[model samples]
Target chain A: MMKIVTRNLITYATLLLAYTLLFRFGLSSLLTAEKWIWVKVIAVIYGAMIFVTAWMTGRRDGKENFLFDAGFRWNLTTGIVWGLVSEGWFLLGLHSNYESIRMIHIPLLIWSGFLVLHFSLFLILKRRTIGGVHKTDIFE
Target chain B: MTTNDTFHEDLLGAWEETYKKGQLTLWIFLSLKEGPKYVTQLQESIALFSKGTIRAEEQSLYRTLRKFYHLKMVDFSSGKGHKGPDRKYYHLTPLGQSLLQSFVERNILLFFEEPLKDLLLS
Candidate 1:
């Protein structure tokens, strides 16, 4: 479990780092005048990709149990959360002399909140369904 | 040359083409025939089974498993522990077993087995 969490954390952190770098360096130059519009456009596109990918990937399962499909659910949620954090930081506080580093706090909070909610909900649900340690579960 | 160098080249060449078409999915299911495996274990077994010719990326492998679970061809349950997230151990369903059997029969096991042997031996 630690291993999986570590891998997920590393992945999420890396993605967060990459996006932060891009937003700070790349976007600063490209959209000096009307940066907010470009950010909104990118957020919308990112959100769309997330939804489309989730829908297509889970198309095989039909409606039943599709929501529980971890890959689709995780990706879609991650995309939505990420899109919000990525765009929200700038939107919430975009002073002409804003320090980009200060923007990290909100995204970090959102990421942590997401990880907490997702894992807690999943663990609770799994405990209810499987019950405690039992012999049949082990061998079968 | 070392085995690693030989296989790394193969990864960039023939394997990439095959993988793009989802041939790796068979190898994944095939590896689970003996018993259930966690995702990391499954990845290791597949690479060892193929003698380093194929190494599945984590995202793709998990996505495939979820797809299989949705199709009812496979299922998973958590391993014993109260640690972080449960370690999901995946096993084939009866449906998955039949599907794998038919796949092997149609392709002739040699189609996969022979190439792997020839790659390692030669």
Candidate 2:
């Protein structure tokens, strides 16, 4: 549903924002340019977009369903997309310092952020499976 | 609290069944704990914590969540909506929380145990 999509957007967006801030002000020293404000703004914009997707999804599920279990598929899909965006384009661009701003370094930044989150969620899901998993899943 | 005086026993019963039936267990627990929270909150919660069933499948999760609401283990509130009105809310009974606590506690501790914690790598 549109709602779930929006929710996923928001979740991804918020996480992106957090990372942007962390890299910008929190870890701004790494950036050669300290005067740039685009990082924060862009992070908020795109980050919010991600959060929106998560929020919308949440709304669609309405806390009644086990979205935790189902959300994994996206993780795989997101991973493939992120791999291309993050390592693929990112290294290609950042290595040579091509523009490296205004969505230049942004796509991969967002991708990595989502990657970490997705992996974390996967780990959690794996645990829950172990926590509550029955042998049936493995053997049959 | 004493089982006789609290809903813990019933809550645990639900949790036991939760593994067998993922989302339904979660919805039921949420309904008991939060008093009709929006689905947005639940999704965010699961994403953040390793507490319940997540990473299973998308449409299925969506389907089950919807089903519980229809089943009446969950209810919507008049809070408008934080994620949006398009978002629905859920509230769990005290019975539900206690049940969640049982397995959650055990699993949490067990999860942190020897081979699980990666102390070997550490």
Candidate 3:
């Protein structure tokens, strides 16, 4: 389906861009932003995206967000790896001052935003495994 | 009746039981997907789940998702396309796929009713 293709493209493309930009700059740039205003603004936007994404996801899943079964151990590990990988990529970009690095906040925030969902999902799934589904009645 | 139908009847009965008791939160979950959808979209899509069949607060929907978070059947992540917060979204997990698969492939707790009459009705 077109939607699946598009989703895959967007997901992978964003991932590719995240790494590309990460290679372009260093983590230091995050702390050493040319404009603190954009940095904060982007952070707020990223935080919003995190909240909205989780909220929307919650609505869709009906309070049983199962993907989180993997738990915080995996989520946090992936989050850190994701952040580090992007940071490393951006750090690389910073050295050459690549023109490809536009809207620096977008990709960085995306990386952060994923972390939030990762945590939620981890919690959800882990909980389900522990609690078990509500017992189904045998007769109608 | 054939053995298959006989078995399906039993499964169907179980599905009905859970469905009636409100324990089958799993059904509402299948309606939600990875893409963004309005509340109305879900209300219409699920099987035997007509409009107003299960009225819920927007917040309640999120609350139910708490169990799913536990079940590991579904999850949410950030949307790729927008900056706005109005449109909500969700996606199923590997476990959810397996759960749905068990119903279809194994015919475990399969539901067949008048609306979809040809299915294995109990």
Q: Evaluated with lDDT, which candidate comes out highest?
A: 1
Ordered list by lDDT, greatest first: 1, 2, 3
Which prediction has more favorable lDDT, 2 or 3? 2
- RMSD values, in order shown: 14.7, 16.6, 17.0
TM-scores, chain B, all models? 0.72, 0.44, 0.50
Given candidate 2, what's the lDDT at residue A40? 59
What is the DockQ score of candidate 1, to 2 decimals?
0.02
Give the lDDT of residue A64 in candidate 3.
Answer: 31
Task: State the lDDT of candidate 1 residue by residue for A30-138, as single tens digits.
Answer: 4556577776676565456545544553453322222332342454346455556556656765433433645556666676777677767765655533222221221
Ranking by DockQ: 3, 2, 1
Instruction: Report DockQ per prediction, comma-separated.
Output: 0.02, 0.04, 0.09
**Candidate 2 lDDT over residue span B41-108, tens digit each:** 66556554545544434444455445444434344555664455555555643444565688568755
Q: Per-residue lDDT tens digits of candidate 3, residues B1-122? A: 99999999999988866665653354455576434344445444543454444444555455555555555766666544355565545567777667666755554333444445555553
Candidate 1 lDDT tens digits, B1-122: 89999899887877677544656767887889979998888999989998987778887677667657756778998896456677999999998899889978887566557776688678
Off by over 4 Å in 2: A1-140, B1-36, B50-59, B66-73, B82-87, B113-122
lDDT, residue A128, candidate 2: 49
In terms of DockQ, the best-performing candidate is 3
Model 3 lDDT per residue over A1-140, tens place: 00112332334335444543443343335545565465565556554654454345434432333222333333343355445555555566543332234444565578578777876775565554345342221101
| Residue-pair clash count for candidate 2 | 59
